[model samples]
Target: MSRKLPIVLGILFCLITNHSISQVIKEVEGLYYNTTGDLYTGTYTEFYESGNKRIEMNLVEGKRNGKITLYFENEKIQEVRSYSDGLMDGTWITWNDNSVKIAEATYKRNKKHGKWYIWDDNGVKRYEMEYSEGEKVGTWYIWDENGNLLKERKF
Candidate 1:
């Protein structure tokens, strides 16, 4: 046998015996789960009935605990969210069907806690707002597609 035979056999064994580690464990109502680790921490993905990816998110202790991505039926990304210990705690972004960014915001424990921006499908800035713990604060600006300020307000 070649010197590399043992290594190759070991890899083959792992591939055959551990395939379940990456296999989807469950599917219910169009959702699929793939988990590993002692705590079963891994990614869980859901598919739309149209066969497009609906959502893909990480799970820690079976709770949403990491980056989450959502997709439209056309396979375009619709939104991206981050979670820590099952609560939203980081950047969140959304895009329109045309792939133009529609909104971007930051969250701390599922609450809007930072600057938020909105744009139209034509990629024109529409609004900008500030928030603290989900409450609107500071100044906000609204503009038209023609780059004209439609309104401005201070909270």
Candidate 2:
């Protein structure tokens, strides 16, 4: 074989292998500031090592704004929360790894402001709580997995 032919073949092999390896080595990829205390506008996303989506959120001048969604490594929806101008607002919902609704709560300016519901990992309702601007104000309930009324208390 010609000496020039061997050198060209070696270059081609290195380029192909390096490209594929770089794709996996990139663990964290997103559109954000490169320095601390810097906020980039628009949506930014993160992913798990397995390439599954981890979190996706929006930012306006580096403050949390709009809706944020999180997911499980298995690609299931984990939580969906809303925000306004860097504060938690509107309804927030969460689910289990099995894709079952686990809990839900409301917030206004980052404080709990309304009813909250919770369920066990087996998807059974376990609690119903009320909150007023981060403070409990009314009746709260608890239940067993068999749908039995376990307890009730007023705050």
Output the worst ten-in-a-row residue range by lDDT, candidate 1.
29-38
TM-score of each: 0.73, 0.76
What are the per-residue Cα lDDT tens digits for candidate 2 across 1-155? 69999899998886675544333222223333423435567666777766577888887766678899999998788999999888899999999888889999999999999999999999899999999989998999999999799999999
CA error at residue 72 for candidate 2, angstroms: 0.7
RMSD of each: 6.8, 7.1
Model 1 clashes, total count:
0
Q: Give the TM-score of candidate 1.
A: 0.73
lDDT for each residue of candidate 1 in 58-81, tens digit (9 for 90 to 100) = 877656787899999988999999
Please tell me which predicted candidate would have the highest TM-score against the true structure. 2
Instruction: Give the alpha-carbon lDDT of every model.
Output: 0.81, 0.81
Q: Which candidate is the best by lDDT?
A: 2
Reference-based lDDT, residue 5, model 2: 96
Model 2: ten consecutive residues of lowest lDDT: 22-31
